[model samples]
Target: MPEPAGAEDWMPRRLAARRAVITGAGAGIGRAIARRFAAEGARVLVADIDSGEAESVARELGPPALAHAVDVSREESVAAMIGRAVDEWQGLDVLVNNAGIGIAANTPDTGIEDWRRVLDVCLTGTFFGMKHAIPLLRAGGGGAIINMSSVAAIVGVADRAAYCAAKGGILALTRAAAVDHAGEGIRVNCIAPGTVDTPWIERITRGYDDPAAARAAMEARQPHGRLVSPEEIAAMAAYLASDEAASVIGAAMVVDGGMTAR
Candidate 1:
């Protein structure tokens, strides 16, 4: 059995004794969530499509931490991921569907294949995680599910037609899952972040004519005039995973620096 969180964990050890699996944990927000969950005393499984990166993160987190290569878009891969957790930890608890990508394309530029790819990974991938995880969670006496959404899910962003559509779909999926599973002690929620400072954003900005100006423009979207951090999102995930958020059901916790307030 995994050891209960010590007093030295982040956020006062909110997620003690929990076992969590975070997808796309190779880098960015997924990586932050894995680390944060570990710090809070949970044994984390760093799941990513990239085996090397996932193993690296697992090694970084040390004992009780394991790495697995999983392609969220594939149902078999997702099933294997959940199975590994239950097999290794003897049960399951929390799951973070954080693997996603963005394609710079408007409705016009969004080809059929492009749309399918975005939806497959961002939307269907979340579905696979939830579908396979729910049973294990119920067996383990219920747990929390936090899906990673975006500001685009709530509002709109130009040239992100496919991405926005997929994110928006996640909101609907989250709510439905929460309502269906609440009676079983499962709490489903999502974090809709805006302009988070992660490797993804850095890559997007680097493609711009002036990376600095691109960053400034991205930051300007949020009221705080800066991008949110991966650590910040992880903090909220910790709270959601804990019993403290027992009442927070089907809620889309917007940690977008008040970007949607405008």
Candidate 2:
């Protein structure tokens, strides 16, 4: 008879045994992913523009987590972040491209600078992260990449022309990467979330004339009558990173509380 699998032989076990680098991990969905991956036994490199917050999260995750201050929009910064991960972890296996910004201005009123800034962080940042990450992933023999897109990529929202364009660009980028690297044992996918109740969303609502009303309207817009949680998005990221999701490539998973159902 065939021998039974050892305690550690199970697939998808010890997810944290691999090494991962996540951008924007100082807060929101990125922070949640960092926590989850650390819990799963993966050594995590938490990279964010906010150095203090990144260090705090890394400390909270204890020994296996490393923190770095990274501006993903810049090629050199992104290259350094990826290089640090390889140096610290010996190699990199997973990458979560979660750094992004939101801009709330109509196309006509959106200043050239604002549009450029939003695109630089949201779209160009993702591109740079992917560019730097692929070599490491290839060196490691293969890996999974999760790009954080948004429901905005699928549907129109007012006063967010730049944000929408950047997210839409991410979806296309995700698809292209998946195809380009499939032969190299790399899997690429995107997650498009709805109105998630992160600090960013809170800030957006707080600026409204009726903050409470605006918050309620945001909730009401979701078919679930609530905003998506950072943890929920992190859960999806974990699944995608696991071997169980080996065939889930070039796909855009929507975690939007059925917002796109209509």
Candidate 3:
């Protein structure tokens, strides 16, 4: 039997029934990804240290989107968060470790405590996310893990010693996990984004002596002369989680708008 004329063979949403857990989903890029995932019909668990903000984002997403508080640096919290997602959706399909912090200082100027804090939240936190999410993802069959790396991971930037270390570590873990889990039906990857137009960047620019000049300097870093949008990153997340990227594993997909072209 032939199909009806003009019948498009596709779904209205890309991620239907896909269970996803996105950390730092309260605001900035995390919030955008959560929103985008929910829009694509994924059952999302919005996890953040900020409980109120997490709830708000989940509420806005409607049913099947739940909110939870999680300190990603803590293994217990990460475990509980992942457990919640599994409990709600019956399993896990995608895990996006998007929570991170930055410390703006050179190696000589960065304090021990500052470096520890940055690594604890950015590097260790990602470790926790992957450690807990991988088992469930494997049990439910092959799934995707998207770590949020940065241009700092692949390039040297002034006044970003701690951030560079943590993000660079993420790149290492992403690749290692991809290798270790490829046989387990799990795919691990990462996104290395350039200067993005998020609240975090806005706060940095506003704190500078000349906001306009500071923002212009950031814009100049990327050849596109514009910051990447959170939604654009979300789109990448969608693709990585969907079957469309079945063969994309251990890839640090650069979403830097040619910032590292030089």
Residue range 182-248, candidate 1, lDDT tens digits? 9999999999998889999999999999999999998998899999999899889989999999999
| Top TM-score model | 1
Each prediction's Cα lDDT score?
Answer: 0.92, 0.89, 0.89
User: Which candidate should be chosen as best, given lDDT against the real structure?
Assistant: 1
Residue 142 lDDT, candidate 1, scale 0-100: 93
Question: Each model's number of backbone clashes?
Answer: 0, 3, 0
What is candidate 1's local distance difference test score?
0.92
lDDT of 3 by residue, 190-236 (tens): 99999888989999999999999999998988898888999888878
- Estimate the TM-score of every prediction: 0.96, 0.94, 0.94
Which residue pairs overlap in candidate 2's backbone?
16-41, 16-42, 17-41
Q: What is the Cα root-mean-square deviation between model 1 and the actual structure?
A: 2.1
Better of 1 and 2 by TM-score: 1
Write down the RMSD of all candidates, one decimal each.
2.1, 4.8, 4.5
